[model samples]
Target: MTDLESADRLTEARVALAEAMALHEQGDLVAAERRYRAALAQDYRPADVLPLLAGLLGRLSRPEDALHAWDQLLAIEPDHAVALHEKGLTLHWLDRTEEAIASLERACALDPDNATALGNLGVVLADAHRNLEALRTFRRALALQPDNLHLRHQVRRLGSGAVPFWHIPMMNDAPRNDAFEAAIKAAIGVAGPEARVLDIGAGSGLLSLMAARAGARKVVACEMEPMIAEMAQQIVAQNGYAARITVHAKPSTELAVGAELDAPADILVSEILSSDLLTEKVLDTFEDAHRRLLAPDALVIPRAASAMGCLVASENLAGYAFVGDVSGFDLSAFTAFAPQRLPIHGTMTGWQRLSGDVELVRLDLTQKKHDATLARLSVPVTASGRAIGIVQWMHIDLWDGVTFDNHPDGYHDGGWLQVLHSFPEPIDVVAGEVLDIAAGHDRITLILWPLPRAAD
Candidate 1:
């Protein structure tokens, strides 16, 4: 090429580069993108211009174009950290999470000290629902930038958000803890210290720690939630039971007899029951434990748990369970979406019992097998009122005599709240009339519904 033509081409590329910078500064992303591409076409420092173009494309909400620009830069400078980071962001915007993770990981490896990159990586991991990994990434970033409020917030959110709200309350519930410890001590006394105890859903390692404190030599606890499991491990170590208790961050179903446990556990201590007996899949978890993880004659901590409830009427609860007229509209149709069950602290909520406590369903955990069954329950009403539903609590037979119940009358401030099994609609009953209900479980959930009365 002639010297004059080359100089003209160089000047044209410089002009395009200058125009792109000016346009970008003016917030004219579309024009800046055109000038950037024009400069690149004229071969004016393609490497430097590519990042600006890619960023401009991203600002324009053109992820595909930004991705292409990033690829072009990466092809030229394969180890460009900023390119990789921005590319990861664009990929995340495109919902290409796995690719974004790979790119961000590469960028992090290249620039280990970059807290912003690490934080972005954590956000992507969280979006992918890889919570434990996200929490770890956020923690690493937080360690690098301790004073960063966003990093601190992310760490706290991922760490605390992964745990259920009931865990703290359940841990602080002295009565509940005492009851479980009593049951564990009783089991350990019978089985001896050599008993291998398996604790399913071991939140905070409380139950397993109790077992270890009660003289159980070997305690294997499994929590399905990884965050809670990690905390349980920390708590066990803090309580000096780390050597005796091993907390596995895996669901009970994933645990095998020889793998997580040396052999089938001699004692099964699981507090997987929800406010309502079966919502936590207690029956399924227990049945699986018996079938795989527990010895045939293993001493189950709660040998039996019965769901006890009474017909109730509560004005405060009615608002939560049913909705009728609003500002002016008949929104009662929205009642179809009302909650089937509502958790309530019995002492705190104002409710009147229409019938004495009736046994809705009973699960014998020692049976090793359970079938979903429903039967007729005749609740003898003692009060004339509008019955919303049955307010249910639990009566757990932990061992021979070690029993616990969250009876609404006096048992307050415990982890176990009396759940209201809300009905489809309110029923008005006479003082002496009997209310029939279909009461049982579907293995995973308790089935309680009002049955139509026979012809008057």
Candidate 2:
């Protein structure tokens, strides 16, 4: 084409672009879209025209078309940060999560300071259940924009959802914390200051910090939750124990002898137990740790744990255990679907013991191997009442002499709540009768079932 013809075409394209922007601002998206296409057809700065067209298409509720327009811009300018960022958003709108993540990640890499891109990437990652990556991305965005309240809220919100709700309460429980700390100090003392300590499930890096404060030279802690792990790192640094402690944001199963730790640790401290003692896969976690992360003779804190409880009878507790005749209708069948275990605050919940405390099951944490087991137990009734089920609590034998128990009678305001293993139906009995029950564990859950009473 001649120079005169090229200049004439450019003038026409500039006029069309101006008209498109004016129409778009006036809410006439259909007319604006036509003008944008006209400018693009003339190849009048396709890079700039494509973005405007893509954004207009999005406003027109044409996500697929908008995606294609963004792609066209990317084809021309591969590293265009705005194109990549906008394209990522369009892909996410289209439910193309993986592609969105890829585009947003590239945009972030191209413009490391783009807090918007980083925040969008974090949202996608979180939607995909890639919480660890999402948390890290959110943290990076917060670092870039320190005063961004939205970013700060995302960090805290995601962090809370990533970890269990009971963690903060557990940390605040003076009795539990004191017991664990005492056990940790004792273990460090016995293992000597040079002992290598491995703290699995480092919620707030409390155990690892305790190890450091006890003069351990090497401490390695791993938290599966990314947000918690990051906070742990900060807490360790704040406490001036960062130099002696290395926190890995991963599960104990992911740790290696030479990577997260210099060698097999001499002491293993983990508090992954659930209210029922085994629901948190404590067995699986500990087994994996023993096989890979700890020495053969590693000193394990909480060497043993036992679930103890007695037969319980409470009008208030019975209401939660079995339901029947609600508003003159028989809903006893709904009892079959009731919660097998109900967590209750011992001090607040109204209950009475029908039998003295009985050991339901015990786990030997120091053992190298374990398997699921079930055994019979007999509890002599101490009072005659309608037994709903057994209200059980934990007794952790930490170290040799340090022990902790949230016994339903005296222990209150702790993270450990007594769990009621409800029966299928209420049973009545006399004071001198023996109630035979089956109690044990299936490795992942606690088992408690009442046996049939013998005919008189």
Candidate maximizing TM-score: 1
Model 2 lDDT, residue 110, Cα = 99
Candidate 1 lDDT over residue span 148-212, tens digit each = 99999998898878877776787898877888899899889999999999999998898999999
> lDDT of all the models against the reference?
0.90, 0.91
Residue-level lDDT for 151 in candidate 2: 90
What's model 2's TM-score? 0.89
Writing each residue's lDDT as its tens digit, candidate 2 over 1-456 gives: 999999999999999999999999999999999999999889888988898899989988999999999989889999999999999999999899999999999999999999989999999998988887998999899999999999999888888897676777889898888898999898888889999999999989998988898899899999887778888999999999988999999898999987778899999999988888999889998888889888998999889999999998999988887899999999999999999999986443998889999999999998878899988899999999999999999999997778999997898777778899999899997899899999989999999999988888
* Residue 101 displacement in candidate 1 (angstroms): 0.9
407 in model 1: Cα distance from truth in Å? 1.9
lDDT of 1 at 279: 79
- Poorest 10 consecutive residues by lDDT, candidate 2: 344-353
RMSD to truth, every model: 1.8, 2.9
Error of 1 at 351 (Å): 1.6
Worst 10 residues of 1 by lDDT: 344-353
